[model samples]
Target: MNTIEPRSTPQPHLTLAQADHQDTLRNCVRRSLNEYFRNLEGEAPNDLYPMVLAEMEIPLLEKVLEYTRGNQTKAAEMLGLNRGTLRKKLKQYGLL
Candidate 1:
């Protein structure tokens, strides 16, 4: 007879340095936003969401593609994105 065993939950294996780096990245975004708000000089912000997403997405895709040596499948896997979705983003960002 064959028996199946229950699976245990997987744990993330982030190191202290990685955690610190994550915090640093958050702080950098916070600082950049604060600077942007300051520079607005009483003008209202417009389309901030898409602006930030585009700014972040371009470099993220570029670096990941570079890291994977332009392999979309591996890059999508690393990004937890569907390959087609990654291709759409690549095309949207004019990287395709």
Candidate 2:
């Protein structure tokens, strides 16, 4: 079977007025993290790495698999993960 290529990263097509907001992904991440840290109110945060990855990874995998139309190999290549690793994650997420 021919493999479906993953879609290219989305490009913004905003008007001049909309562009002024500067709502890019980097800014969004920065804003979100800043808000998260601010909400902690001086409490020491622990396991942030795993926490962040766990939060992001599921949606990342879901989007990639959806882009690849449920094809494991192409999704793996697109994600820069080995096929087995991708399969494991997919299985873990109940996608497979």
Candidate 3:
């Protein structure tokens, strides 16, 4: 007969040094994204914020809905939003 070994529970611990390192990493990523956006704005002739956000959100929402097999409830749960809100966004983006 084969027996399975018991697995130990994992401990959750965050030391001060680890926390500081995480904060530094977060700041670096924020700085890098900000710089990238600034460069994009400089290169583009028109204001690109809304256009960029809409373009990004459309494919992202479609992929998420597809991953949930076109079920809005599951997609909303995965997105941490209410079903109504997800439906509204889908309609607004003409994906519904």
Candidate 4:
């Protein structure tokens, strides 16, 4: 007879180094935003969301693709993107 075992729940833990890294990321984003507005110098910024997303997305997709060695399945898993979404982004960025 086959038997099934109950699964244990996962315990989440945050280390001090992880907390520091989160703070560092927050600080970097804050600094970048400040610089962006400063550079505007009274000019209004347009399409900030799309602009930032595209800028960040391209490099992220490139790195993830490289890291996975063009394995879409693993890359999608690492990126928390569905396979279809990952494929779409890869195609959009012309990496596919």
Q: Which candidate has the highest TM-score of all?
A: 1
lDDT, candidates in the order shown: 0.91, 0.84, 0.81, 0.85
Which has the higher TM-score value, candidate number 3 or candidate number 4? 4
Which lDDT tens digits does candidate 3 get at residues 1-96? 999986987757978766655656465555656776777766753655676568667887999999999999999999999999999999999999
> How well does candidate 4 score on lDDT at residue 45?
92
Report RMSD for candidate 3.
6.6
Model 2 / residue 51 / CA error / Å? 0.8
Q: How does candidate 1 score on lDDT?
A: 0.91
The regions of model 3 sitting more than 4 angstroms off are 1-44
TM-score of each: 0.75, 0.66, 0.53, 0.68
**Residue-level lDDT for 62 in candidate 1:** 98
lDDT for each residue of candidate 2 in 1-96, tens digit (9 for 90 to 100) = 999987898877988767655887666666778889999999999999888776678888999989988888999999999999988987887777
Could you tell me how far off, in angstroms, the CA of residue 59 lies in candidate 4 after the best superposition?
Answer: 1.4
Between candidates 2 and 3, which one is better according to lDDT?
2
Which parts of model 2 are misplaced by more than 4 Å? 1-21, 92-96
Between candidates 2 and 3, the one scoring higher on TM-score is 2
Cα lDDT for residue 30, model 4?
Answer: 65
* Residue 44 C-alpha lDDT in model 1: 100
- The parts of candidate 4 lying over 4 Å away from their true place are 1-23
Scored against the true structure, residue 31 in model 3 reaches a CA lDDT of 63
